[model samples]
Target: MRLLHSKTLEFATFYGDATPPYTILSHTWGDEEVTFEDMRFIQKRKSLPEDLRRSPEFMLAFDAAARLLFPPNRDPEKLAGYEKIRKTAEIANRRGHRYFWIDTCCIDKSSSSELQEAINSMYSWYKKSAICIVYLEDVDISFPAGTWELAPGHLTRFAASLKSSRWITRGWTLQELIAPGRLTFYNKDWEPMISKYVAAAAISSATKIPPYVLATGQLHRASVAQKMSWAAKRETTRTEDMAYCLLGLFQVHMPMLYGEGQHAFLRLQHEILQNSDDNTIFAWEPLSSPMLPSIYRGLLARSPEAFSSTSKHQVERSYFTTEAKEGIRVDLEKAPLVLPSGEVYYVAILGSANGTKLSFGDIHHLKQFYMFLKQLDEPNNGRRKQYVRVMGIPNNAQHQVQHNILIFHAETICVRQQPIIPLNFETTEFSRFVLRPDTYSATGLPDIQAMTVWPLGLISEKKEIMIPSHSKDFTALVWLQEHFNSSVSNVQVLLKFTRFPRVGYWCDIITGKQWPKDRDSVDEWRKAIERNHSVKELAQRKRYRIGTRSEIRTVSIEPGIHADQICLFVNIDGLII
Candidate 1:
């Protein structure tokens, strides 16, 4: 059958014997008759939905109504274009009620009461449609002429039309961006594609302008609601027709929560009726407009084939057992955990493993390991002491430590690092000395052994000397100068602390008292502690070492006794300037 219709062809031949309940109505000119066909169809189709009332009586009433209280028909071509729309509506109705109630054909023209009732209930009808076909025939449905079947031949045309269409390219039409949340309308510049089609239809009908073409006007004379009303009066069927078309085109082109099937039509009607108003425009938004688009996009991105399948998140599973005294270690260097369903999770092992020992990286690995251990039904049980030995490191330094294990909370992650680098410098008497103690305590160090180095800024071994969290940006720099500077600008100082105390609960090695070896009182060291502000310039200090070979010799002023003092003083600028 030829797709295009000649201008204003009378439907008398189609209705000649097609009895009542089948009157043709143009949704654009509500209750208004098209030509004189209504007089013939009135008795036959008068009992149907009012939208079908293209009878002369309905038009007369509609016209009289407009003259009484409503405005004039400003959009005449949109009025004349009604017949062409009715023809297109015929094409979408072929599947019986498989596509019944195709609004354009079902509404009766002789009954204004039915028309009013239908218009008022329009939202529900559109929402419940079996197959809402959006005849973006106004925007050119992508396919060859007369081709509506799903075929390979239609694919190329579909792609090409989509690429060149102003709707998709400029993102300016209802069909192009119908996400869930907010309703959008295109501004004028991108109106060319659809407007040109309506314009051509208007010209063919020998009309000056269509109602929708008034959308071309720069002035915003009508509120969106008012314009909808105008559209409604022109033709209730076309109003709902286009709205259904827009909604259907949206479900097809953009993201929708449902998939294709027999239910596609039902879902379309539900969505359209739920969202549209009596004027056949969108209703007030039901969801948060901002989040609606995201939901829409998500629906679009979903793979339709997998809609009914179970999801497998990329997570790994493992099981292991360890002995009480000797630990059993399984290296996880980029290995996948195998599962019964053939699923796998990749894991990378950071290793330098030993029994009961945990390194800093090992400490982090323990948290995940603990979870795995619990999965295996094993507990810590307080029998094994965890130890960490630095065996092979990039720095080539070997050190060992017995970790004081504490139960870690499930939600808490690893501790944060401090600014100072831990100086494990080897001294002659004591092999390793931690110059900065703040770094140790931040990592939860219980205590430090051997050589004592007290940083002057620390109030005690218990507290750290760092800028407070709430201070303004530059406050740390200001505090740095107060303790170290006589001239503030160029002065430098050193502060140190021992993580391990020597004798009492809180005691450190002090000078200027009796030496443990010689028992001689060194008064010179006492004078240095009193001058706490003195900047140490290392270039001027006399450095002496004491101790035997292979027994690391440390720098010393003189051997002093360990004292029961809560804190110690060290002028670490190397030499007082």
Candidate 2:
């Protein structure tokens, strides 16, 4: 470790227990800040080139050094880094500390190993310091402390300015704020502002960091998500440093990879998962972009912002288990079903809070289902009756037999309104609905509302049955098929039969002309529609030829039944025939 001599204005190296107590400067990096090279030149008594000495950063370092090294010859110019270092040394000297460390000049950043070591040890260094001097360059204060305190409405403005300081938003300063045992804030003119105790609440409200963690440095007491939320809005100059700066807060370390870009954060998440089994790490919601299908989205979160909501709640670690022996086990007798585009997914039975079972085949599908449930759960004039269940699956062979499964429950969404008929055939659960040939002209489209329906059920490895139903239910199912035409052919669709005011019958669209021949052949044809078919191909398929001779024209698929027939069926009372 490197420490700057408060009295001598010279740099000294210390290792292990030989290091003396030092005050550390915490401030945002400025473009003109001094560097280790500048300090070395100053220590060697070498004359800096005219241009170099004229630089704002070099001048600041020189002036600060002059103030401490020769007390009577301090410069009076208002410069960025000069006052911060000068006041910090003055405060440390008053407190009887002979050394202080400023990030810009203390360590040689040109050396990779030294830089890495410094970063990894920064938290401990700050924690063991005599005091952490926070320089809020953006905050302004009146010269006389008593007069400033006595000014009308100054305290409120001061608090607001302190809370909104650029010092708090820098990536490296996050650990500096949390890891220190004692900290004092100083305004631009080096006027004493407030202690960590006096400004705890305001800091907490501004940063979304808990007051307890700031006061006691008990970061381990907070869940991974809550800790991550502290750095959500914070930023670093280099993208990768966004993750590196957070190393101490998570108490996990990995080799620094500066050029890896955003993947650095992904690696951080990988390292975090290894040390802790908190599943809340996966509970982050994606920003802006449409949610990726579950299978395609990796375990890592894009940014700390994902945990913003989780941080607000008092998270309990007891909700997740680190021990494999305590994890919930899911068994899959078959390999994951493969889509035509080569993506693999599986179906898992999830138990709902109401004791009913629902099956979600893919993570993306589950997320979609949950989104609908959330909409239904939104509060209106009255409280909405809502139920939700989320269970985490350990990413291990023992907990996941053949496939990964995450189960959630919503009573208002998936509950069966009518008693299921006890049928003797195989049935599948589905949640998606689509409409095909999405456009139509009133003049050319048919008014044929009535249509024949064939309800096919997949039973065993070879047999299928055509279910017989009442004309009304059958017609309703056929009518429902038109509304689902836009859906991907491979998506299992749920069709609801309405009898005026009541939902009379509900069925799942199991298979059509392209249905797999058997269980063993399911994967060969279970390709996702968007993946297997191009936009042009889908568009071509949606068009219809109006006439043969001179009037041949392309039009959207006519409403009702076109050349492509519709098939639908429901399992009578969850029974398989």
Candidate 3:
């Protein structure tokens, strides 16, 4: 089987490198090679042709046709397991079960037009799927395992570049990164399998409507939280109704990536969608199987109201991890078990003290954290609770008031309220997000995506300058100069300056020129600074260096000069006098 190569496709596959074990299969059913387009058509059975419609014999033929597209390989555990499930599913289908859709087999690879059609509808298929099977064949865990492993250096690095790197796109969502690329194909699988592709298409299509508008529409149509509340109030028991209720959530609340139990939940949703109503919600309770955590079930049983929406409380409860992480100096011992759905939240069993000051910002942040925890709460008789609470801290009885410092127990703290957290950032750590030149510009002004790329620099002249990405920009420069020095903090940016190369060597922002020579030492950097700054002694005291750039030059800035005041000299002449 031959693989088609394109700049974006190749880049995606390359980045995917040993990061994950991706299967390379030809789109061939038996002897005929299937094109990607065919895979799309097959994947979107909802849009299948007359011939493609259901027939036990046709299904068998289609499955056989899919086999040829796969690359030859000894059965790896995941593939082998998938194949086993496929066979069983096919058997069920033959017996007149509605249908079983597996992306690898259902998608036709022979047609791009068809694939394009299906690609746009991926979200619906996921949201509506009976089950979404997430197969994690491999994991690239180059990062250290322990939370304390996150040191000052790590935090600095995070603070400096966390806002502007492709790292977020590295793990499960690489499909979104390097998007409009083949990795996007994997995106189809990222959705809830029980869903169809219609809503996804409408939201992502090139129509004049804004993307967020479409997203908002999807959110509106699938108001999972509203319905869940209704279901709870009505005391619905039909599994199908409950599943539909869950679908709204799977699409909106759950992380938009493949996860354990996500697929099973989708399947349960589909079954419930087909068979039950509010009264039958509990009928499928027995069928819940082991898709999501039992804790969710416990929560559902206790206070069905909790699963309504993803809010501050629910987020904390759902994503919170109890593992004490470094830099997070909260005493779990003083905290109580928080159930976000109900009012059961961690109160500072102790209040605040003036002498022992705690940042109100921390308290606010903790409030949001408590919100997440509230959502994770399930209704249970007072006998036992599914969650854990901290106990037995000696009350600072000596102090007038105790500070009830708080944090969320979920996955990562920063992601929960990025806008606020980015500003309150007093830590030695940085947050990074990477921005593509084309994507940055396409996003239009004040590119938040660009700002996420820390120690920011531009990929092109057209794109607006952002704080983290354009680290050389006056503001970014000052921030770097003042804060960029640390084991954790490092700045390496790629600039796509519009103009051509200059005669000498150095990264100059004014001319958009890149010099041929490299500045290797701190002394060399000092010389460069001396040329730029009149105060030679100041230049000596303030260290600078050549930071790496992609297509253009990246210069190191020292503390004191407000980044806003410092201008990138297109040529030496452009340097501010």
Candidate 4:
């Protein structure tokens, strides 16, 4: 552990029991933070050549150099991040603490091992703090000390002040909120408004954390799903910090992989599952994109955001076990919904089934947690069949319940952190992308033909692209085709752009002539998917060999693509089937 001298603000390294009792500072990071390097520079500058120290006038003339040399010629307090450190140390010193810790300057983050160690031990560090000082620079309340009126709506002012506080909405601040039972919240002016104990109920209302949990710091009081729900709305500047920040809450530790992105959350869930038998960890349900689909996802969730509504959901841990390679196997409650094709989908009941409205819906019957799952054979792990989450199907239809003889059956399926196929990335940057045909190819095929694609539902995606939606839902239906052996034998492709909260760009390429009775595969698909009524008729217009069976092509969303960049890459050689 690293600490500052509180009086001198000089950094000192401590190990295990050698670490002294210190106060920890928790606050949202600024645009430019005072780093460990900055603290080291201040220390080194103190031993500067006596001549340079005496020549304050020379240093002031070169203002930039003065900042590097020492805090002079400019108010270091007004700079981006120094005032918080100085104030934190001042508070700690006044409180009779010898040392203090602040994330920006205490830990040498440049070293990977040191950073990892600090993060893994961060929870314990905060939990052991004599007092955790939370500085909400955005929260300003001019009301004098001891002026809080503890009435029904009286705390409104305090809550309103915290309404815009960046501290509550940050990923790292969550652990800082939970770990230290004895902590104080200071406003922008460094005025102590309330201790965490005094504002537990208000903080709970603001953060969706139970008041008791905030006051007592007993994590066991909340279920896994509830703990996960707290983090769902919090945002982390670094993508990986979303998962890393919750390490203390779950009492689990793992290596910090910065570039791993959402996979970091999956790894966190895996570690939590490994340490504890909490099946509600899988109870997260995404309020999915409105783009109609037969798209499927893996058993694991994409991110903590998916678990936002999981607070009310938790049940007995049922047959939950994770594996290094083979994936996790859990017994799920499978809904009886036979699809058009032989493809079987199971609307597995997720935990919170207590008539509480969740992501599924608020209707009486829709209160239970239901998520779509599709079972498949795992060739690597024998001829055994396992289930992956089915994405995009409407919730009402996906998990249909009737007073019929067929009830939910108990079935076991394997789940892993990795998604099944056509990995979906959650991003809002991709408002829309033009769907155009890419050059087709097959290894050693005689020839490949170029495809010309213009949207049939809308104008050429080139001109009419970036329109929010073609219909009621945020979806755009595009008509395209693939040429196989000859011009006569072609496959008609329908490219449906996902809704506003778009996942990776995907197109359900259902290539087949015959399908089950939703009445005739091609026509029913046309009628089935043309929901919210974007277009009426998409007739084949001529005879062509479409294919033998139905198949959906879900594509992974790549980052940094523009609306003009074509994402439709179709290989016609496979259409020969």
- Taking the tens digit of each residue's C-alpha lDDT, what string does model 1 give over 151-225? 454434443443443333211122212211211111222111222232233221222223333333211232222
- What TM-score does prediction 2 earn? 0.54
| Cα lDDT listed for each candidate | 0.26, 0.53, 0.27, 0.63
lDDT string for model 3 (1-577, tens) is: 1111211121122221222222221111222333334433334543556765667787666656655754443222234333423442443344343333343433454555544434444444443333333322221112233442333343333223322333221221211211121111111122111111222332232222234323333333322233333333222233322332343333332222223323434454333334322211211121232221111121112233333232112211112222121111122212332221112334331122213334223554432222212122232463222232212111222121234333322122111100111111111111121122222123122211122211234223433233231122222111121122342222223222211121111222222222223425545543443344333221111222324322222232211111111112211111111
- After superposition, which runs of candidate 3 have C-alpha atoms over 4 Å from their true positions? 1-91, 94-98, 108-120, 127-577
lDDT agreement of model 2 with the native: 0.53
Worst 10 residues of 2 by lDDT: 557-566
Over 4 Å off, model 4: 48-52, 55-78, 146-154, 324-326, 333-335, 339-344, 347-370, 377-381, 395-401, 416-455, 458-570, 573-577
lDDT of each residue in 1-577, candidate 4, tens digit only: 8899888777888888888989999998986678777777667666567888679885555456656655554444445788888899899999999999999887888899999999999999999999999898887775555664344454677887786787878899899989996898887899887788988888888888889888899988687889989988899988999989899899998998888898898888878878877667767765655563344455567678888987766544545465645467765565545542223455566443322223322223643456666554444536335555656554444355332232455655675444332223332223444433233433333332223332333444252334342332233333334444554333334444443333334433333343234224455555555542444443212122345424333222232223212132322332221
- Deviation in angstroms for 268 in model 3? 27
